[model samples]
Target: MTHILQIDSSPRLERSHSRALASAFLEQWKPYHPGAIITHRDLVRDPVPYLDATWITAKFTAAAAIALSDELVDEFLAADCYVLSAPMYNFGIPAVLKSYIDYIVRPKRTFAVTENGFKGLITHKKMILVQARGSDFRYGSAYASMNFQEPYLKTVFGFIGITDIEVINANRLNTELRDQELAAARTTIQALAATW
Candidate 1:
């Protein structure tokens, strides 16, 4: 059975655009594959600890010697697919999601430093990022250059060997164009759910 890890990173519960899109994606995708195991990680409710001195020490040390947070890494390694709902905060992803990424991307775990520079360890898995932004930052838009969320996420995930990443961006969420953008995002989510 396909195992999907659904991560909701938005602090907003009832009125979060990304959360709603992620829910719609999962609600639609589940029926396409019967008995798919869907694991939910509510980052806001149960925030992953930030990387600190102890965590850094453990990360640089040999895996067998240091006691690291294997549970988070293991969850990431076990998943076949991931559906992440992230909201843009000050032109970037929320801190909770970044913390979760820090936990998963470890040396000799998710990535490796090789003679050829760097290489990703995880392979053949797909990730769908449902992002909500308060402003317009789509490609070629005036504010596009200020967008640090999508590119940062793509790079981070790519560094860990997850290259098949798809982003459904709900931009201009705080503007008068909110409804139109959300409707388009929902349509994209439904379509991707059916195919992905």
Candidate 2:
């Protein structure tokens, strides 16, 4: 059976578009891929603490850091697939999610520095990012360059060796077509359920 890890980062529950998208995806994906085990980690309710000075010290000392980040790193590696809900906060990912990333992106655990540069310890895993944004940041949009959520995620997860990534964006939620766009996203998710 396939294992899936879902991490939701939104501070809001019902009002979060990203969370809604993730929930819909799960509801739709289950029937297509039966017996798929799923795990949940809510960043809002059980936020990953920020890396303090001692945590930084522990990071450099492999043995010490393992105790601090091992659980998260191990959980991350154990998953065959990931579904992440990433809402834009000031043009980038939320602080909670960033903190979570800092904990899991440890050296030697998720990546290694080698003579050839860097090698990712994680491989052959797939990731799907569900994003919520207020502005229109589509490919050719004026503010497209301002969007950092997907790019940064891809880079970080790619560095850790998860190269197969799909992104779903619920864009322009603060606009007049908020409901329309959300409905469109829902439709897209329904279709994706059958395929992805």
Off by over 4 Å in 2: none
Pairs clashing within candidate 2: none
Residues 66-123 of candidate 2 have per-residue lDDT tens digits of: 4647899888988999999989999899999999999999899899999999898898
Against the reference, the lDDT scores of all candidates come to 0.89, 0.90
Worst 10 residues of 1 by lDDT: 61-70
Residue-wise C-alpha lDDT for candidate 1, range 141-178, written one tens digit per residue: 99898899999999999999999998898999999999
What are the TM-scores, per candidate, against the unseen true structure?
0.95, 0.96
Residue pairs of candidate 1 with colliding backbone atoms: none
TM-score of 2: 0.96
Error of 2 at 144 (Å): 0.3
Error of 1 at 109 (Å): 0.9
lDDT of 2: 0.90
